[model samples]
Target: MRIGIAGWFGSDNLGDEILLHTLVSCVRSVDESASFVVFSPNPDRVAALHRVDAERMPTLRARGAVGRQGTAQRAIRDCDILFLGPGTVFQERSPNLPWPGTLPLFARIVGMARLARTPVAPVGVGVREGGTPAGRRLLRVIGAASVAIGVRDQRSGSYFGARAQVIGDVAYALPIPDTQPAAAVEEAAGSARPTFALSMRPLAPDTEAGLLLSIGGCLDRLQADGWTGDFLPMAFGQDAQGEDDRDIYRRAFGNVLGLAGNPLNDREGTTLAGALDGWLTALAGYRLVIGTRLHAAVMAVALGVPTVAIAYERKVHDAFVDLGLGRFVVGPDVDAETLHRTATAAAGSPAEFREAAGRVARQGRIAREFVTATLKGLG
Candidate 1:
């Protein structure tokens, strides 16, 4: 069977890449001989990393050229099933204005599947409010076109009523390295200073300065308390649009002591699994993680690391709450002092945090089973 998987893959976003890797891995486990053609912004990178046939995602104008039978159209036409999303690709928001949002591309993909008489399924997708009318209309079309829609959270599932199953994030299915040391126990055996890692992404211009100040102040307090800080950038490269976590990290924490010249930035590789493995391995060393990226927080918890989530969006908030770590989340309105206090308290009880995270990780396996069952059903 041939599967045409499409979403935000091969964009140098570690989280999306990890989810794609996990999704492909899970599907392969169920059907070893299944062939895949993925749609991605960086098709060469995706092909190199995932070892799958990949075509560049069709641009808005390219959709108009569908009559000419482009590479993307051909891939979709040949597939038996079209799989869409394991990320926040269903949202109404678009980074660029005066342009069609992501929904149009989604609608176009489903349209291609419909024309080819192929089943389209969305796995571990996320949905949010405040979408444009065009976006909402496209989402409805997508919902009706899908054979089965699996959402990553309850909020996303509500959009499709009973058809959308809440399957949690697919990244949970990613295999954790067995060799990583115990969370807090191993830290005690290390040096006197406990390490703290901070992960941040770009925010709106109006709120960017304030958030940076708050994060810097929080990091300062942690440093004063004898904690060494490291900035972990989940998304790399300019192709990631405005969600450049590395650039944001450099702008916010570049000069901060113990954070400057950290080697984590140099650890990523061409392969998605290798990059994720390196990230998780490095994150396991931190006693506390303050993360704005949802996948970064999820990955940290998967490795049994204590994480304090800074919820810039509902997905981040919902994921942490589902994991039973709601107490560690601070909203966008949170002040610098509150962030410091929360991080300090969260860092103090490392054992409790680790235990809670471990419990959530155990529950996340349900998502994997759901994926396997869904794929088998498709067959």
Candidate 2:
């Protein structure tokens, strides 16, 4: 079987990579002979990491110009099925970066797939704040074209009405490593102070400053309670124009331990599985995670660690709400005192939080079942 997967992938974003990994795994479990071709911004990187054939997704410059004869369009035309998403690909809510053409690009991709008579399935996806006009139209087309549409949250399902199935995020079903590095385990066990992991991203200047200040205050309070901090960068952008999470972390907490720096020197001959294992190992050590990035919190929760989600975007809150961990989510307008208190409270209720996360992980298996059943029908 030949399948084509498309999403906001290959951007050095750990979360998206993890989602891709999980989606591929789920599909392979049901169809061992399945072959995949991916559409990504960084095709070479996707090919290197996921061991799949890849083509660059149609960019804004190529918008409305992709014909049936175009390389990417031809590949999709030949594929038996197309899988679109596990990310907030439909959202136009980014304040710093505008994605005016993204939805239209997706519409064209799906339109091309439909023209070729290939089945399209949108899985583990979400819509942010009802999205733009193009995005809403894309959703309508997806509903009309797809064999099944599986949204990651309730709010996202509302966009498609009866067409959408409420499947949990694919990341929750990702396979966890049985063991971490011995040294990592020992360090975490030996540390006298409680460890915390932090994930931050780019935002509006004023909002960014406020978030940093709030985080700094939280760190101060955590330090007073004898907790140490580790800044995790889930995504590192290419070139100067893109936003880098590492830079954001450095600006917020200067010179702190950066887990994203690959402190364990884990990149030597690294594969996707190895990188994911290394990240999971590092995250397993944290007593708490304060995350602005959705996947950072997802990974933390999957590892059974308590997390405080900073909901700069609706998807963040939506994911937490799906996990039944909504109490841990705070908005950008949240004050430092509220953030600190929430973090402290979440940290204190570790058992309950972990249990809730585990339940969500269990629920995520429904996504795999949905895929399997859909594929079986296709066969």
Q: Per-residue lDDT tens digits of candidate 2, residues 28-144?
A: 998899999999877877787788899878664655534423887789988988999988767665654466636667777888788888899888987778367666766787777
Off by over 4 Å in 2: 60-69, 96-99, 179-189, 239-242, 261-269
- Please report, in order, the local distance difference test score of every candidate based on alpha carbons: 0.77, 0.79
Q: Which residue pairs in model 1 clash with each other?
A: none
Error (Å) of candidate 1 at residue 186 is 6.7
List clashing residue pairs in candidate 2.
Answer: none
lDDT of 1 at 181: 52
CA lDDT for candidate 1: 0.77
Q: Could you tell me how far off, in angstroms, the CA of residue 377 lies in candidate 1 after the best superposition?
A: 1.4
Count of backbone collisions within predicted model 1:
0
- Quote the positional error of residue 30 for candidate 2 in Å: 0.9
Clash statistics: count for each candidate: 0, 0
